[model samples]
Target: MISQATIDTVFETARVEEVIGDFVHLKRAGSNFKGLSPFSDERSPSFMVSPAKGIWKDFSSGKGGNSVAFLMEHSHFTYPEAIRFLAKKYNIEIEETEQSDEDKLNTDVRESMYLVSEFAKKYFHDILLNSEEGKAIGLSYFKERGFTSDTIKKFSLGYSPETWDAFTKEALGKGYKMEFLESTGLTIAREDRPFDRFKSRVMFPIQSMSGRVLGFGGRILTNDKKSAKYLNSPESDIYHKSKVLYGIFQAKQSIAKLNNCFLVEGYTDVIQFNQAGIENVVASSGTALTPDQIRLINRLTKNITVLFDGDAAGLRASVRGIDLILEEGMNVKVCAFPDGEDPDSFARKTSYDDLVAYLDTNAKDFIQFKASLLMNDAKNDPVKKADLIRDMVTSISKIPDRIQREIYIQECSRIMDISEQVLTSTLAQLVQKDITEVGKKVKQDQKAFEVVKNESPVQGAKVDVLYRLERKIIEILLLYGNKTEEFEDVFLKTNEDGEIENVIERKEYKVYQRVYLSLQEDEVELANPLFRDIFNDLIQYFLQNENLEIEKYLMHLNSDFAQEVTDILMEDERVVLHNWEGQNIIPKTKSETIGQYVSETILTMRWYLVDKIIDELKNSVSNEPGSDNTESMSMAMDYYKLINSFSKKLGRVMSRYS
Candidate 1:
């Protein structure tokens, strides 16, 4: 864990513009900056940033937050990765909090392995571009493969020298620890000797989503019969082959923008497609496609186009894994090149326009592609045809959307001449069989789903209302909590004549004090979990701590919570800065009449909760034993009267002249 003090320093020192400006092209839009959303394809700008508030909002995507949140969303970085990135950007020294011994060791080991991997990527890439042997062997191989110098450099293509311990000796000479070198599989350590794992091979660095080199795929240049044609880094703490895709680092942005992914089967396929100007492509690296890898793409886009060789046998084998994609509720299509060519060779030979047009025209939805390819031999064989239809229905059942499954079933009916009723019956049977196999677990899930399906809209609206009210409480505390101001407290007392009346008295209190004491008097607690957590933290800070700085307060919070707080603090500013900055838009500010604003907000919240309690009492009083309990009815009437009193108080507090 990063120490709180260090996190505070980093947040304070890192400028939101300077950090995000590196990734997004921000243009001046009144008091804020506007840009196209990085998360979606857009013609006009919907992404807004307010420098004054140190926050941003992507209107197109409904994602808004502080600087770290931007990095986390755009780059797929974890919380620690995002913080460390900001810390590095602002030149802040990191201070780690105390951890368990085991945790410390594990963290250190992964960091070390990552460091070694990064070092090896740079070293091999430098050798490929600069060294004599590397240029003659590795650079020549890439150039011969129709890769431009820019493409080679862009992908960080490299060459490991063809000698034992060549990379190991240099890494050690540079003070790189032997433990990390061997752990990352850059250097294989033996009892008698150490050797480079990728000697005499064209090196392709496999990077994490944030572009950190995790491992390598090395292709041998020579025809050494005993040596494997291609080798990969052995699995280690930092690299898990099943969970990552090649070229994801370079392809993520394009994949998101285009809303589709082209999954290929080799490193050269990815590289060549990117060079041919279609950058949203990756490779399975000849392994069976894993759910983890599909999920990696799922983070960016829901559409996948699996590119394959034209060989029918290869397509048949590969189409089986397309079910995993459908199981994830993703749309899938299959595209293959002409006979005797893969993505690499075809892309290497075709023009960019031709390559794109071919993909656009040849791409077929997975079901259509599967049925067409398999229906050939089954046309004359009735039993095989029945089995094929069942197989198609199985794939259809993997689709989570009922409408999509039905649409594909219709398409299959047209292609295979099978009736929709038959196909639908088959799918139901498969689904029921799955439920039977899952047994108790699925029954519980079905019950949960039914509960969700049965929830009323009014109940949902009440939850939304409560959510907004809780957010408002946090907004008040964060903005005006420490400021002392005049407040009017209304007391309802019975007069000497036994008539109800309101006595208004003026007093001075800090905003936090007024809100906290009011809630305390009413015995009210926030319902939403995040808002509740922030409320308690604000209470402790305002009541106990002396120094009150909003930036420091924001900096000390967890990033996820900080984004939520930043949203609450800046939601109004987003509108003010974007549309009303110079239009004489004099929206209400907490700084003016802060006391009444706080009182009204708190009263409004209490009024709703009181009203809710009255409704619940109505239910309780109308149900169960007595069915006409006077005491419950009296309590309900009292709450109803309280709501009326709250209504009058809110009206008085809200009227500016009062």
Candidate 2:
């Protein structure tokens, strides 16, 4: 268990924007920060962070909370893990009770795999730095590649021994479970014997955005005829090759700061670029680029420059990657090294200044590079050139912006010496064809989901009205609970003529007190479980403290309650009242008439509850034709009158049935 002092220190030291910004590229939006939602694929930004309240909300995924909560949601860290991450990031020393070895066995499966992977990384790295065999083999290999000791340790380059079962024996001897070892692909278990997976190899640990080791990539040292040169950890619960990008954990901050990411092919290319003073670089690890991986970079930048080897044959796959980045609405540039040179080899030989200058001069717009590369093979052949134009048009259509597409098409027309009109026409046809295909796919998907599986036709929207009203009541109490306001008290009593008439008395009470007294008068409770808990807790907070400590309250709220609070607090931010005041359509802010707003919300909730009760009473009488329901009927009539009174308070025009 982490001590309260440590958790508080972490929370105080770790700024919400700083913690989230390490992974997300944030831009100022009014007083808050906005960025693309990390939880969902989106072009427009829907994620918001408010430093004043120390909370964040992702409208796309409906997940919202403070800094620690963001870590938990984005990286799937447990609460203690999140706190520890924050502590480490903020340089705060933590005090916590260490978990016994017995407690480790009951950990989550994914966590166990993560622990094993981390241990493997440490063990291999130690061997490389300390062991004679490792120094002679793995250390020598990295040294021959021109890597310094600092560079070697920065990437955590490690060595695995030649013996098949060396790592497995050590892991088992340390009381590590074989279940996690085999599951993480660190040790391959066979019926006869368990062996190390990467024998005679150099290790590169793959990490998540928060620097947690997810897996490893090992490069074989010896040129064995049968074995592959490079081997990666198999897809496990924590590591998916398609979703993981090599060096992302190291490159994220630099990419976000520079506003561009350098895309390379292999692990060495990334390390070499970083060693050359270019830190914003990552590799696909020789796998085809994936949308998921692109999105990981997308969260940090809107620009990517692909660094290609001199081989034109390999350029085809990188061209496909360019199309993917364009489809994601990002600006892409391509640069290729001279013949017989890749980023790794070139960066190793060239000075940092020369490498930077070369990259700047060689980088070309993606569309131009693609057309010129393809044009080389299609030269002097009208038939082949025409095919090239169509292919270029298809790539252009992947662009989401019309202005950008038009610009690229004009560039393509100039480069190909073709008419602008012809390229534009071809582009339009391809775009229309894509739309038609999408429509057909949507219809097909609808047909596939035609089968109904529910036992009853329950309309979720039917109950939302009351739930919203209850939620609104909580919102009002939370925002204005400590504020004292004048409220009109209604009473039905005899007048001078001895006739029952409505009498109104105005009284001063705190917003929380009024809500509590009103609800207590008729026994009303919030319908939504989350809203109910928040409402009671918020009332208690207002009662105990004069000043609202929103951050303190947030410390105890689960993501669900925090989401509700953020939706309530930040909903007004989403409402754009742009230029409405100029047109004499000024909106009334709740702060100005908060008392009235609170009363109206409470009245609306009461009215909804009374109406539901009246309906239930009516249904009961209607279902029993032979029995008399005089008591229930009288109770429903009273409820109807109460509804009328509440409707009047809420300024709703409902005809009185009584």
Residue pairs that clash (backbone atoms under 3 angstroms), model 2: none
Q: Model 1, stretches more than 4 Å misplaced? A: 1-80, 84-107, 443-472, 479-510, 513-552, 558-597, 601-658
Using TM-score as the measure, which candidate wins? Answer: 2
Q: Residues 383-452, candidate 2, lDDT per residue (tens digit)?
A: 9999998888888999999999999999999898999999999999999998899999998887766645
Error of 2 at 458 (Å): 10
- Whole-structure CA lDDT of model 1: 0.83
What C-alpha lDDT values do all the predictions have? 0.83, 0.86
The local lDDT score (0 to 100) that residue 582 gets in candidate 1 is 68
Highest-lDDT candidate: 2
Q: Give the TM-score of candidate 2.
A: 0.85
